[model samples]
Target: MNSIKQTCKNVKTLVDSFLNSTTPIFCTPTDEPKDTEAWYSTWEDNYIGDFLNNSVVKAGLKKIADFYCAKQLDVLLRHSSELKASSYPQLYRIYKECCKRLGFVKMPKLYITYQIFGINALSLEVKGHKLILLSRMATIRLNEKELRFILGHELGHHQQGNLVCHTVNGLLDTFNTSSEIFGPMISDTIEVPMKRWCRQSEFNADRAGYICCGDIDAVTNLFLKLGMESVCSAYNEYKELEDAHPHLQTRFTELKKIHKTIKVNR
Candidate 1:
């Protein structure tokens, strides 16, 4: 665990350095409205309202991604130190390729780890700067293409710039991580919406990932290896949403829809 913590600290340092040097597109404080009501009124019933509503969701997604990346980095440093030095050089390289292919000039940093608990695969941090985290164990379990897609998914969160989501997530962590006794009702109220937003944000990220990966098979196979198929089978057999991720069929369908739109525009 000491090694894991050390690795996490190093990754955090790297992320801080990169963020310090990089200027964010939307980090400026504008005279724009702060509340959802004002935003909706200003947008005049456009999709911007939905975008504002999604702020909290986006932030939460970032926190989750950051935590997952930290965990993955720890795991990678512990189990695959040599592979980290050898085979994993391509990890960030492929991610950069994917980003460039998708027209993202500033590729988000990819932090790797062995494992992460809870329902996180990857996440992005958008507080002042953008950082991404990936599970090393998850990456090792996946093929090159899938890994790239996963990283792209996290980058999507960074692009989304959802600080409200991150704040809620941070609050939840504070409640759980602390010794304070919070009631189930309050916890449930905060958690349910957060989970729903997380699922929705993932769909958006899937679109981003598909665009970056540029290969449907690579993205689909990554989901499959992440146990999507098993979850689908279980849901069919038992009638339930069994996994944290969106249903496999739904995710695939959405990706295809986005891919078609992107191709038409291109």
Candidate 2:
């Protein structure tokens, strides 16, 4: 029993380390339009473009559009003192608009650190504080539009503080550390559903990002770039999970569909 307990502890440590090392996969946009143009051209020449132009993509995009409309610029900036008062007023306005549309009321405390390994953004709902950490490496490289979208994505998690569900999910993850008798059963009963829900949440957040950025094209481009970067990264193994967030092409397609459908209905 003591040995079993020790083994469980070791497994927990290993799992935690694995999770911590995994960074939020995202791509930093190039500062120059020419650079972006070149990359875009290359991407379009590749398979991603083919995936984006598919019927399934169109359907997904339409689903997002039907669910929510784009947010207004003024309403978005109401809580953002730093952004509203900045020289880049337009950028801040865009950010605020996305937040408003997504009904993101609370601002998570932002932390930056070079020491953090793997992830780009983390949203933690602790006892009293909702904390968000953005990777300095990721943030320093993003264009204004990309930055706002990423921030809005984190805000999406903040708004989704359905505590009971989160707590249950956490407990299940912990319990599945060992116990061969219960491990596979618990994973199937809990982890699968949790991951599916998380993926759905990502779609919602992507919609929020498009609304905040005020440009589906920008959002799609950013997604494509990020996907490429993810594929290039050492942590690219996460992408191998069929159950992870929908493929990048699917997401981009969904966004496009949302934009088109909303425009038609409006």
Q: How accurate is candidate 1 locally (lDDT)?
A: 0.53
Q: Report the number of the highest-TM-score candidate.
A: 1
Tens-digit lDDT track of model 2 for 24-124: 22446865322001110111132222322343332333233222322321232232233232544554464565555555554455555454443366555
Q: Give the Cα error of residue 62 in candidate 1, in Å.
A: 10
Residue by residue across 158-183, what tens digits does model 1's lDDT show? 66555335444555555654644543
Runs with alpha carbons beyond 4 Å of true place in candidate 2: 1-105, 116-119, 162-174, 229-244, 261-266
**TM-scores, one per candidate:** 0.55, 0.53
